[model samples]
Each structure stands twice: as structure tokens, then as C-alpha cells.
Target chain A: MRKQHWIEVGVGAFMLFGIVALIFLALRVSGLTLDRNEPSFTLTASFSNIGGLKPRSKVTLAGVVVGRVTDIQLDTKWYEAKVTMSLEQKLEGLLSTDTSASILTAGLLGENYIGLTVGAETDVLEDGDEIRDTQSALVLEDLINKFLINSTKD
Target chain B: MIGLDSLARLGRAGLALMAALGRSGVLFFQAVWGWPSGQGVKLWMRQVHFIGVLSLIIIVVSGLFIGMVLGLQGYSILVGFGAEQALGQMVALSLVRELAPVVAALLFAGRAGSAVTAEIGLMKATEQLSSMEMIGVDPMRRIIAPRLYAGFVAMPLLTAIFAAVGILGGMLVGVDWLGVDEGSYWGTMQATVDFRADVINGMIKSVIFGLVVTWIAVFQGYDLVPTSEGISRATTKTVVYSSLAVLGLDFILTALMFGRI
Candidate 1:
């Protein structure tokens, strides 16, 4: 009986520990943030070349992450890449209408994210508003080709 | 005559393999047909204790060593390129997506799968299973079901623990010993490794491995020739077959989950 009791305790402990570990992995190890209660608003921008930008990529303002790219699609009408992002609602009226969005890489050969540069305007950007000025991602191959051509000419 | 005999032998081998697969499938359904009720819960608990709790020490020790080795290797390689901050991402992704499930399943096969096969094979060899049947208790229900269920429940949990410990071990090596920024190590990991895509997918892989390995173990044990030599052979088969099945199924599962099709 005593041995049986110990066995039960051991199983119980194992189960409990396993559950805790799973929760830890989900909350701490993975990119899942549990406290997403803070409301956010969506914004759209159009670019000529998104390069390798993917959904769930970060959107940064002044080197700090402010939003995430929620969707990326080809704008069939304009022949441009359309990117939709969600930003924290607290900064809703702070971004000017002339603010520019650019695709930037984290480091050389690293993941790509959208970076925002503030512009001089009184009107603030709101949800569903499109940023007029957008910079496309710099294509490394294109840059290399241009560099090689310029060096050869010189 | 020689050629004809060789062809006949190959055909017979193929037929026997198919028959064995069919039998294993049927036995798995039988084991999974019902819920644990009354004394069944106690039997399951005992099996869990035997299989899961006993296997914890090996899982943790191996997970830790493997993670530390990954950290060391990743640091050396990335340091050359000045990308040492990605070490945590590399270690976490590999452990969460591949190593934790595959290696843990392989170990579980060698440890618990073999033990279950041996125990059941010995019972059969000693005529204990027959005695249970003679007493009007179905040995399949009484002996096999609980063990199979215990394996199903234990494996994913064990695998989760393995991955969690492995990540911590990587942090120890990458951050403490290697002088990588502690903030960036964990921050990059948390930013990159998706819970749904990597972690949950790994859990799913372990669950499938557990089912297949346990099914193979119990089926091999129950269908043995009930001789001492047969018992030994079946035990060996359990480990060998389980490892192969885990590896093969991992490929299919990976292709299905991450293939974007």
C-alpha cells in the first residue's frame, strides 16, 4: 500500500512538472505574448518591392517595435506590393499623414521589418489610412549590379 | 529451382510484413477502444509510473547535454560571422522543432519500449497471460490497454520537459559562459520561435511517435512465439522498429506541417 502511494505521488509530480514546462515553453520560449489586451489599429502602405518581407514581421518607429505586419499582398491594380500592419492604439493620432514607411533589414542578411520616419504634417494618420510616401526594400542583387557597372565605368 | 525459390521467399517475406502491419493496426484500435474505468485507472497509473517517471532522468540529462553542445557549436560558427546573438534562436528552433521530439522518442523507445516488450514477453513466456485468459479476463484489456494509454499520455509531456530544459541549458552556455548578451539571447528566441509552428508541432510529433512506438512494443510482445529466444528477439525488434518508425514518420510529419502545401 505504501509503495502504491509513492507510485501515485510520483506520477502526479511528473504530470504537474510536465504541465508547468509546457506552459513555460508556450509563454516564455515562443513568440506568443499572453497579455495582448492592449488595443491596436491597422494601417496600410504600398511599396514597389517588398523583397522578402513576410507577415508577422515587426514594424518599428525610431528603432523600437510599434506594430507587426499583419498581411502582405500584391496590389493587382497598381502592380505594387500592399502591406497591412497593426499598431498600438495609444499612438493613434501621433503619426503625421506625411510619415514615410520603409522596408529595412535588421542586419546584413537578417530578417526584414518596416521602419517609419516621421514627417512634418499637422494631420495625424488613423486606422485604415494609407501612408502616401513609401520606400521599397533595397534589393542586394540590384545594388551589386549597379555598383559593378559604376565601378567599371569609372 | 534456385531462382524460383528465392522469388518465393521474397513474396513470403512481403506477405508476412503486410500481415504484421495489419495485426498491429487492429491491436492499436483494441487498445484505444475504451476509456480507463474502475481498476483500469490504477493500472494506467502504474504503467505511467513505470514508463514516464522512470524515463525522466535519462530525458533531462540527454536534453541538457545536447542543448549545451548546440550552444557551443552555434557560438563558434556564428562568432566567425559576428552573428552570435542568433545562437539562442538556432538552439531553440532546433531543439523545439527537431531534436527534442526525435531524440526523446528515440530514447524512450530504447528505455520504456524495450522494458514494456520484455515485461510482456516474459509474462507470455511464463504462461501468465494464458492464466489471465483462463480466468475469463481478456489479457488485451487487462494487460495491454493501460500500457498503451500510458505511453500516449507520457511522451508529449516528457518531450515538453526535454525541450524546456534544453533551452535553459543553451542559455547557460550561450549567455553565461560564452558572453553573449543575456537580453538578446532570450529576446531573439522569444521573437522568432512561433508557439504554433514549432513548439506545438513538436508536441504533435512526439504524440505520434509515442503511439507508434508503444503500439509496436505491445504488439511485438503479445505476438511473440512465447519462447525465451522469441522473447529476446521481440525486445530487440521493439527498439529497432520504434527508432526507424520515429525517424520515418518525423519526415512525413515535417513535410506536412512546414511544407506550406
Candidate 2:
């Protein structure tokens, strides 16, 4: 009877250990953050096309990640991808009203993200400020088409 | 006359193979149907102890060693390109996506699967199975079902433990042995790995592998020929077939899950 009870307890321990391991694996492999610790402020930007830009894509200034793009919506009137990003609160003084935002690719084949080039201006953009100066993603097909047209004419 | 005899022998082999497959299918369902009986609970517990609890140490030790090797190799390779910060991503992705499920299942088959086959084959050779049948006891329900069920239940959990332990092992080598920044190791991993793409699919792979390997192992045991040599041969076949099936299914399952097949 004691041996049977020990087996039962061992089985129970195995099951409990298994559950803990599974949860740990799930959290680790998913890249889900344990704490939402970054204090951030939201801003909007308009782009003609976002290409492969996603909601969780990084937002960078001078190649340093300062925020994450949170929401992307289609602007029906402008016919463009309107992106909402949340930046770290520390960048408020550094970015001006005239900052230029471009959808940039990381390396040759990396994921798409938002890159900011600061412009010279005294007025800092406030909360909910829409970035007006922007550049869209470069589509390879369109560039090829333009190149073909120019080459044929020449 | 010789040609006719060889053709007849080939036909008989084909018929026997089909008959074996059909009987295994019936045994699986019969066990499942008989699962609600009172003794079923006790039998399942015993099987789980045999299959799962006993196999824990080997699985954990192997997982750690594999992870350490991955860490050491990954660090060396990435050091060349100065992209060693991505070491966490490499280890986690490899473990969750492929290695953990496939390797652990292979090991399980060699250890638990061979044990299962030998036990069942011994019973058959000893005439215990025949005696049980004479007494009108359904041996499939009593013997085969619990073992099969326990395997299915225990496999995914074992696989998850393997992956987690492996990642932890990678951390030890990457952080302590190689002196990688601890924060970056975990941070890069968190930033890159996607839950649906890596973890869920990995767990699914492990479960399917468990089902396939266990099915082959139990079937090989239950259908063993009644002889000493036959019992030994069946045990060997269980290991061999389970390993082949796990690897082959992993390739097909991976393509289906990851590649748009």
C-alpha cells in the first residue's frame, strides 16, 4: 500500500512539473514580456504605404529602439496607412515638430520598422501630434516598372 | 511451379500485414471504449508511473546536454559575425521548433517503448495472454489500452519539460560559460519568438509524435509471436520502428505546420 501511495505521489509530481515546464516554455518561446515597464507617449504618423510594417514593429531614432508601433489603420481620404506609435517619454525633448518619419527595412532582408530623422525646430511635438513629414515604403515592383519605362524611352 | 509458390508466399505476407493493421485499429478503439470501467483508473495510474515518472531523469539530463551544445556552438558561430546577441533567439527557436519534440520522442521510444514491447511480449510468450483470453477477459482493454493512453498523456508534458530545461541549460552556457549579458539573452528571445508560430506548433508536434510512437510500440508488443526469440525481436522492432516513424512524421508535420504545403 505504501509503495502504491509513493507511485501515486510520484505521478502527481511528474504531472505538476510538466505543467510548470509547459507554461515556462510557452512564455519564453512566444517572446511575451513579463512586465509592460516602458513608460510611453502615443503619436500618429501618415504613410502612403506601410509594406510589411506590422503592429508590433519597432520604432527607432538614430537606430536605437525608442518605441513600438501599436495600431495601423487605413486613411480612406488620403488612401494611405495611418500608423499609431508609442514612444518612450524620454524622447519628448529630442523630437521636433518637423521630424521626418520613414518606413525603413532592417538590413537587406530584415523586418520593417519606423525610423525617425530629427529636423531642426524649437517646438517639440506634443501628445497625439501627427507627424506630417513622412516617406512611404519603397515597393520593388513599382521601381522596376519605372526603370523599364525610362530605359525604353532612352 | 517455383514461380507460383513464390507468388503465393508474397500474397500471404500481404494478407498478414493487412490483418495485423486491422487488429491494431480494433485494439485501440476497444481500449478507449473500455476506459470508463472502475479498474481503468487504477490501471492508467500504474501505466503513467511506468511510462512518465520513470523516464524523467533521462529526458531531463539529455535536454540539458543538448542545450549546452547548442549554446556553445551558437556562440562560436555568431562570434564570427559579431551577432552573438542573437544567441538566445537561436537556442530558443531550435529547441521549441524542432529539437525538443523529435529528440525526446526518439529517446522515449528507445527507453519506454522497448520496455513496453518486452513486457507485453513476455506476457504473450508466457501464455498469460492466452489464459486471460480463456477466462473471457478482454486483454486489449485490460493491458494495451492503459499503456497506450498513459503514453499519449505523458508525452507532450515530457516534451515541454525537455524544451524548458534545454533553454535553461543554454542560459547556463551562454551566460556563465560565455559571459553573455543576461538581460540581452532573455530580451532578444522575448522580442523575437512568436507564441503561435513557435510554441503552439511545437507542442502540437510533440503530441502527434507521442501518439504515433506509442501506437507503434504498443501494437508491436500486443501482436508479438509467442516465442522467446519472437519476444526479443518484437522489442527490437519497437525501438527501430518508433525512431523511424518519429523522424519521418516530424519532417512531414514540420513542412505542414511551417511551410505552406
Candidate 3:
């Protein structure tokens, strides 16, 4: 009976370890924030076409991710996709007032994300300020259509 | 007359299913009704050791192999798109979201689940269950309930083991075998997976499947006709029905939890 109790306890410990590992893997796989004290800064951008851009898409400066697309909606009056990005605190003061945002593909065939290009400006852009110089997603179909028309004219 | 006859048969089938459901519900309540005595607790612990501890090797081996396969496949495809760094994200998401819980349940149904059905079915065939009842003991509370609870408790842990080991296996194939940077593999996975949406949902799936597989195994055994042939038939049904139930429930749960997004 004492042995049985010990065995059960051992099994219980094993199970607890497995559960903890499971939670760790889940957290690691899914990019949920672990720290609450980490501050986030949200900025907005407008584009003619977001293409396949969706919420939670990575926002990158150069090749490294600085934040994520937190929300996306239609700006009914302007008739464009309005994107809101939440950047990590470390990326603060990195964006200038003249900085431009572009929707860029990760590769020739990969996920679409917003790319930040630094501009020559001493003044930094504050939160809630719009990124004025923006490039929309390049639609493949439209580009093909333009190429066909140009070839026909030639 | 033909239509009426078919309707009557359909009604009969539905009624029988309902009665079976009601019986199982009663059995479940009875099993959890009283605080377990020391002997009963001991019996349960032995069963858990068999159902969970004994099956660990198979779960680990299968998990590792499956993860390796995912790593290989994901690398081949991602390399084409020059996004091989996302291999970790792909492997982790696929395993946590679908593979681990569903595969573990299938293996459980095939291995431990089948054994349980056969054991209970044999005990019934030998009149042990009846003899116990004759001595004023409830076979359900005494015999079936402990096994049922053990299965219920063991399944989630088994699934967790499967997922965890599978992720490591992916690392083995992706990082060591394929020359993927270990930092990027782990980093990308951490950046992509969500605790509540992907991981917790997978656990919930395993929990539901645990109840389903055990319920089918115990019910099939309990309702077995008293013969050698009957025991074999019940065992077969236990495996088949449990597998089907796991797959079917997985589809429904996935649709509910992830379909819209």
C-alpha cells in the first residue's frame, strides 16, 4: 500500500511535467505575449489593396519583425484598407515623420507583411500618427494585364 | 406499408440508441458516486499504471517519427519558397493543432482501448461480473468505473507527451539533419503559436476525445453478450467505434474552434 502510494505520486509528478511541457510548447508555437508590463505602441496605415494581408501579420523593419498587425478594416469614406499595427517598445523612436510603409511579400511566394523604410527626418512619429507615404500590395493580375496591353501596343 | 415499416424500424433504432445512452449516463454517475475505498484506489492506480505508463514508449516513438516526417516535408516545401525558417512554425502549428491529440487517441483506441474492452469482455464471459453481483457488489462501480476513470485521466497526459516529443523530433530532423539554424527554428515557433487559441484548444480536443474513447470501450465491454465470440466482436467494435468517434468529433471541434478564422 505504501508502495502503491509512492507509485501514484511518481505517476502524478510525471503527468505534471508533461502538462508543463505541453503548455510551454503551445506558448512557444503561438506568439502570445508572456509579459504584461511590456508596452505596445499602435500606428495606423492606409493602402489601396491589402492583398492577403490580415490581422496578426508581422510588421518588419529591414528583415526583423518589429510588431504585428493588430486590426484591419475598410475605411468606408476613403474606400481603402486601414491597418493598425502594434509595435514592441524596443522599436520606439525608430519611425520618423517622413517614414514610409509598404506591403511586401516575404519572398516570391510567401506571406505578406508591412515593411518600414526609414526616412531622413530628425522628428520621430508619435503613436496614432498616420504613415502618409504608403505603398499598397502589388496585385499580380493587374500587373499581368498591364504587360499584355503594353505588348499588344508595341 | 413499406414506408410505414421503414419508419417503425427507424423509430426502434432511435429508441434503442436513446436507451443505451441513458444506461451509460447512469453508469457514469454511479462510478463517481462514492469516495473510493483504499482497495478501490489501489485497483485504480494499477490500472492507470497499465493504461498510461505502459503506453509511454509507443507514444514517444510514434511522436518522434511523426515530427520527423513533418520536419522533412515542411523543409522541402518551405525551401522552395525560401521561407525555410518558418519550418518551426509549420511543424509546431500542425502538431499542436491537429496531429498530437487525434493520433494519440487513435493509438490509444488501438492499443490500450482494445485491451480494456477485451479484459472486461472476458471477465463478463467467465461470469466474474455476475458472481460479483451475486455477492452484492456492483460490477459497474467496482470493475468498470475505475478503468473508465483511469482512461479519462491518462489520455490528456498521453496527448501532451505525444505533442511535446513530436516537437522535439521535428527539431531533430529540421535542425540536426537538415542544417536549419536552431535559433530560428525555436524562435519562429515561439513567435507564431498562441497559448489559448492553438495549445489550449488542442488540450480541450484531447479531453473530449478521452471521454469518448473510454465511454465507447467501457460500454461495449459492459454490453457484451456472454460468449468467446461475443468478447472478440465487442473488442473489434470498441476499436472501430472509438476511432470513428475520435475523427468525427475532431472535425466538429475544429470547425467550431477554428473554421471561421
Candidate 4:
């Protein structure tokens, strides 16, 4: 009975430690900020495809991340991918009415990110405004197939 | 005539083995599809509690050490090239893409996979599987399916734990030990690491590895001969085959995913 009790305790300790570790990890991944001072606004971008895109995916402009993708859904009427993004307060003035969103690759075979090409229009994009024009990512497989077909044709 | 007959018999045996493997593969898919309707969900919950919640400490401790070592080693290498700022990206990418899933799978195989083999092997030796069949209960659906589902579901969560701990470990080394700014470390990681496909690819691999490990364990255990030695052998085979399959499948997946990247 003593042996069994020790065994149970050992197992319990192992489980408790693991749970604590995982909780710590989840907190890290979520980037739970305590500051609460960082002002941010939301903007939406529509795409034909948003393959593998998820919430917390970084949003970049000119190779610098200014925000993150907060939510994604399929648009009902247009049958398109709708991605909602949150931008840092400092970047609010940078976005304009004519800003165009494009899906870009990080490396040769890296993950896809949404790149905002800030336009020169004087009208600044407000909170809740949708970026009208967007470009979807060129999937690797499609590009490879296209290359093969074109090369074969030549 | 005797030589020709022997050759024909050999060919028939080869064909039969192939047929068995094919059937096993089909059965695997059937088990997966039938999971929602079967008692698979209950088994899955038990497995998650056991494999995920239970094994959390080992995963975190191992993950933390792995991250620290990776940061130390990665920093040393990058320092040579004047690219120490790249450490965050290196650590995050490595943890998310490779170390987390593979390490989690290996550990799960040792902890839960061995238990699975032992449980099933004991049942087989005692003719419990046979008894279940006699009562019109399909052992594969009731027993094996749950284990497989549990493994498949638990792997990704375990991998997530690994990634989280690993990043924190790296952060500790980067910020506390190396004096790198926390903001810079996170900022670099966010900028350099491709989040979408890499995370998806890792999770997909975890699910596949989970399925393979569980299948191998159950298959070996259920087929164990009615002897102490046979049970031991089944346990050994389960670990060996599952590890090999995980490594082999990892290579294939890496090639398919990163080949174009």
C-alpha cells in the first residue's frame, strides 16, 4: 500500500508539472500583454484564397510587421476569404484609402504573410475600413505546375 | 516440377503478405472515419488525459532544455557570421517545424506507446481479444480505434506544448543570459518566421506520426504470442517500428513541404 501510494504521488507530480508547463507555454504563444496601453485598430482584407492562414499570423508592410491577423472567415456573398487584421497605434497614419493587400512569401519555401502596399492617396483608411483590392498568394504547387507546363510548351 | 512449384508457392506467399498490408492500411482509414460514431471519442478523452495532461512535465522540461541548448548552439554559430539577431527565428522555426513534433512523438512512444503494447499484449495472451470476438464485439473498433484516435489527437497538443516551452527557454537564454532585449527577440522571431504553412505543416506531421505510432503499437500487441518472451518482444517491436516510421515519415514530409520553399 505504501509503494502504491508513492507510485500514485510520483504520477501525480509528473502530471501537475506538465500541466503547469503547458499553461506557461500557452500564455507565451498567446503573447498576453499586461501593458494594456498599446492602441490598435482593425482593418479587413479580402482574398480569393488564404491557404493555411490563421489568427496571430503577422501582418507586414514593406518587410516590417505592423500588425497581426486577428480573424479569418469566408465571405458569404462573394465566396472569398475575409481576413481581419489589427494594426499597432503607431501605424495608423501610414495606411490610406488606396492601400492594397497582397499575400507574400517569406522565403523560398517559407510561410505566407499578408503584405500591405500603402498607397499614396491623401485619404487615410479609418478603423473598420476594408481594403478593396487584394492579391492572393501564389501557391507553390500551382507555380511549380505552371512552370512545368510552360517549360513543356517551349 | 518440384522447383517450379516452390517458386509459385513463394510468389503466392509474397502476394498474401502484400494483401495483408493493404488490408491493414484500409482498416486504418476505416477506423479513422468510424471514430466519430464509435466509442472512439471516449477513448480519445482518456488518451488526452493520459498522454497530454499526464505527460506535460516531461514535455516542458525536455522542451525547455532543448530550447536553451538550441539557443546556445545557434547563437554560437550565428555569432561567427555576425547574425546573432537571427537566433530568435532559428529557435522558433526549429521548435515549430522539427524538434517539437519529433521529440513529442518519441517521448509519447516511450510513455504511452509502451503501455498500449503491454495492455494489448496481456489481453491477447489471456485470450481476452478472442473472448470479445466470441461475444460479437469487434476489438479493432472498441479497443484499437480509441488508442489510435487518442494518439492522433494528443500529438498536436503535445507538439504545441513543446513549441511553447521551447520558445520560453530560448527567451530565457536570449534575454536573461545573453542580454538581448525581449522585445527584439520576439520582434525578430515574428518578422523572420513564416507562420502559416510552417505551423500547419508541423501539426499535419504530428497527426500522421501519432497515427503511425498508435497503429504499430496496437498491431504488435494484438499479435503477441501467448508467452512472457513474446510479450517482451511485442513491446520492443512496437517502440522500434513506431520510431522508425516517425523518422521515415518525417523525412518524406520534409521533402514534400520544404522542397519548394
* Clash count for each candidate, listed in order shown: 0, 0, 6, 4
Native contacts matched by each model: 0.90, 0.84, 0.62, 0.10
TM-score of 1: 0.96
Per-residue lDDT tens digits for candidate 3, residues B1-261, read 999999999999999999988987876777667335767887777777878877888998999999999999999999997888999999998999899999999999988888998898889888899999999987876888788788888888888889988899999999999999999998888876778788889989998998889888888888888798998999999999999999999999999999998
lDDT of 4: 0.79
TM-score of chain B of each: 0.98, 0.94, 0.94, 0.89
Q: Candidate 1 on B1-261: residue-level lDDT in tens? A: 999999999999999999998998888888788457898999999999999999999999999999999999999999999999989899999999999999999999999999999999999999999999899998877889999999999999999999999999998899999999998998889998999999999999999999999999999999898999999999999999999999999999999999883
Docking class of 4: incorrect
TM-score of each: 0.96, 0.81, 0.85, 0.64
| TM-score of the first chain alone, every candidate | 0.94, 0.81, 0.89, 0.74
Q: TM-score order of candidates, best first?
A: 1, 3, 2, 4
B42-88, model 4: which lDDT tens digit per residue? Answer: 55555556666667778879999999999889888978876677788
Interface RMSD of 3: 2.1
- DockQ, all models: 0.86, 0.60, 0.45, 0.10
What are the runs in model 2 whose C-alpha is more than 4 Å off?
A: A33-56, A59-101, A105-110, A115-132, A137-154, B1-9
Number of the top-ranking candidate, with TM-score as the measure: 1
Docking class of 3: acceptable
Off by over 4 Å in 3: A31-33, A90-94, A149-154, B1-15, B32-44, B73-86, B122-141, B180-184
Q: Which ten residues in a row are the worst by lDDT in model 1 chain B?
A: B28-37
Model 2 clashing residue pairs (backbone):
none
Candidate ranking under DockQ, highest first, comes to 1, 2, 3, 4
Query: Quick one: ranking by lDDT, best first?
Result: 1, 2, 3, 4
